[model samples]
Target: MRRKARQQTKAENRPRFWGRHAVAAALDNPERRIVRMWLTREAAEFLVPPKDIPVTYAEAADLARLVPGDAPHQGAVAEVERLEDMLLADLLDQAEDGRPLLVLDQVTDPHNVGAILRSAAAFDALGIVTQDRHAPPESGALAKAASGALETVPWVRVVNLARALEEIAEAGFWRIGLTGDADTSLQEALGPKRVALVLGAEGEGMRQNTAAHCDALAKLPISGKMESLNVSNAAAIALYAARAAA
Candidate 1:
């Protein structure tokens, strides 16, 4: 009886994806193991699950109660198992396509990370790299912010970001760290080669050791009055620039 109770607790702790886009994307992802889904009648028509998947019809208030008090569930919610973490080497191994990869350094905010994932998917970047300890776990808030990009993009979490940067460098990617003080503009620094765009946290920016691993450092061409852009906005601009350059 104790073992069964523990199992039930573990199952409940698994991440729950909420909102229309987030739940729809999870259903679409072949790798996602959706335990169950709850949806209102209106959302049910918009997002049809596979024939084999179990679903429950619930009212908006019921869905709201299932998630965090403030979560915007958009009439749907899904209990899902976390995706397997990918190795840094596995991500680097597939670098033949010359796609730009985004690396985050201690950017702990779930919303920023999710927004970055959205931009990464938009630009068709290879994937996102984050430190295992510093990053947030997959959650409903993140999935909501990603707006379906969470399922589409592969997020790689590594033990040591600086060392991972070394591996990225070794993998033929020219790591470009974005900094406000950098002498070169992002446009001028980017070249016709595989690139890795490294961004740090909001206030402190990239750590010194992390910056040291990069091949070059550059800054966005923004107004001098502004100290720095939000991490997500910066990621979007960087991705757009990288894609445009490519």
Candidate 2:
């Protein structure tokens, strides 16, 4: 219980992010409030923080102590507050036609979520939606994996995923749930102008209720030898197909 409380506190407060890309992106994002930064002289040379932000120059060895084990900090580390909460309605209002929206159903792995965010940015996605309780909070590992995409993508966390899906449908998006058992191919389900690609966790896949919320269920065209793809890989493929279709 104490460990969980500590983790919750870390997520709520200023979390230290390392690696050049993550640190540089955070420094660039005007919405990001950097509490402090510790950087090697080389890292400090490139990452210029706001005039108000404090910076401490240190050696790479000293910087290693600030982040987790073998995190590849790349000589940069920044303690930053999380970005402000974003509303799903605001995202829907700003969404453009043909820009796919990626939705995660209980995808709790920070690495996978981060990779998905990178892919979302690559494909010019509108945004990503996830259940607040089921999603991983912003952290160093996730940010490093995203490689700066975390700052570029708009992420919205909702209280209830089903209700959020309902809202997405009302906003003119055709929700397609990706599952291995689905009979329809993603290509067959890709004719919609606005698409919301819903993916679930790897093994359990989407919840019954979550799948029910989608307009259709579709699967990737992987060979039968492979049973399933990682959720992040699946999201990238779905985004590509949706973009092509659009």
Candidate 3:
């Protein structure tokens, strides 16, 4: 119980990012505020942490102590402040014509969210949206999974996902909900130049209300043998299809 309490308290405090890519990206992003960094001697030689931030040189074993258990820190770890909250309105205003918006409904796994962010960056997506309450917060595991895409992609969290869908429709995006039960395939639903792809949680799928908000319901064309793809893999495939259609 005490260990659980300690972990929770640490999560509530400044996030510590590990791995070389994650730390390098954090150092490169002008908006990111790195509180402190711990790097092995070899890693310190390559990563030029800002002079303003305190950096400590340590052995690989000592660096391991700074992050979560068995995390592949790759000789780098940094405590950082979370990025500022982004407004859904601002994201919509700044969106480009060919870039699609990705929305999440209760997809709470940090690693999945991070991989989705990586795919979003690869596809030149406008940004990603999620309900503030249901999504995972920024963390070391997430950053490592993202492999630096976390720094490049914009993530917007809102209070009401359904209401946010309404606003997205108002912004002229054709909101398409991805579900296995949908009669239409995703390819057929790709007519609109501006698209908003909404994906639900892994097993529970999208809530009824959330599905009702979409302009169309569609599913990926996959093999019959597999019941479902991992959410992150599905997201990458969906993003690729969206890009190909454009």
Candidate 4:
């Protein structure tokens, strides 16, 4: 009974999650009940508090106290609930008429997706589309990589990617697949219309049908020096190129 009681007490102090991105993202969630947020002087400056939730100012050591031994809290800590999942259908329905979408074929790495989310959000992307079967659930490292973009970016996971592409196409999106061996370059092929940038797992690249279903397949004009850019990086550049075309 005593050991169980002690364990429960520690659980309360254990942060809901670690790293700045996770905590910052959690803070932005309307559903998150931020009882008290601790931030170092440096971290405190950048955060804009909503009118409702009260904030706390604490030292860097205070943030360290809340996380694990090796965890880098980046001088901010927020307590929040587990993630909430948004349906792909709902997101598709909500998409605006002209906004571009990004569809991940089967990319499983959370950190990469999270970083891509940051870039997508930076470029004013509509939302992220992923296959439900091959993606990671919300986790600490992913949130960190997202740099608080996890909260801002709506991640829509679908049952079937090919069909999702079909739906997106039916909705008037021009599905563009990014690949290394494609005939045209990304800059040349990006059309002035809604686009769904399809990307795949790192080494294998896009699945055959994923490549086949796209409106067009194009490559980035790298010097062919490196084998390929990371999928997330390629996706980021592709999204940027798409935005530039817009």
Candidate 2 steric clashes: 0
Shift in Å, residue 140, candidate 4? 1.3
- Could you give the C-alpha RMSD of every candidate to the true structure, in order shown? 1.5, 3.2, 3.6, 4.5
Question: Per-residue CA lDDT of candidate 4, range 114-142, in tens?
Answer: 88999988998889988888987666667
* Ranked candidates, highest lDDT first: 2, 3, 1, 4
C-alpha lDDT of candidate 4 relative to the true structure: 0.79
lDDT of 2 at 208: 97
* C-alpha lDDT score of every prediction, in listed order: 0.92, 0.93, 0.93, 0.79
TM-score to native of every candidate shown: 0.95, 0.95, 0.95, 0.79
Candidate 3: stretches off by over 4 Å: 1-12
Error of 4 at 42 (Å): 8.2
Write candidate 1's Cα lDDT for 200-228 as tens digits. 99788999999999989999999979989
**Candidate 3 pairs with clashing backbones:** none
lDDT of 2 by residue, 188-225 (tens): 98897999999998688999999999999999999989
Candidate 3 residue-wise lDDT, 28-92, digit = tens: 99989998999999998889987899999999999888888899999999999899999999999
Count clashing residue pairs per candidate. 0, 0, 0, 0
Please say which candidate is ahead in TM-score: 1 or 4: 1
Better structure of 2 and 4 per TM-score: 2
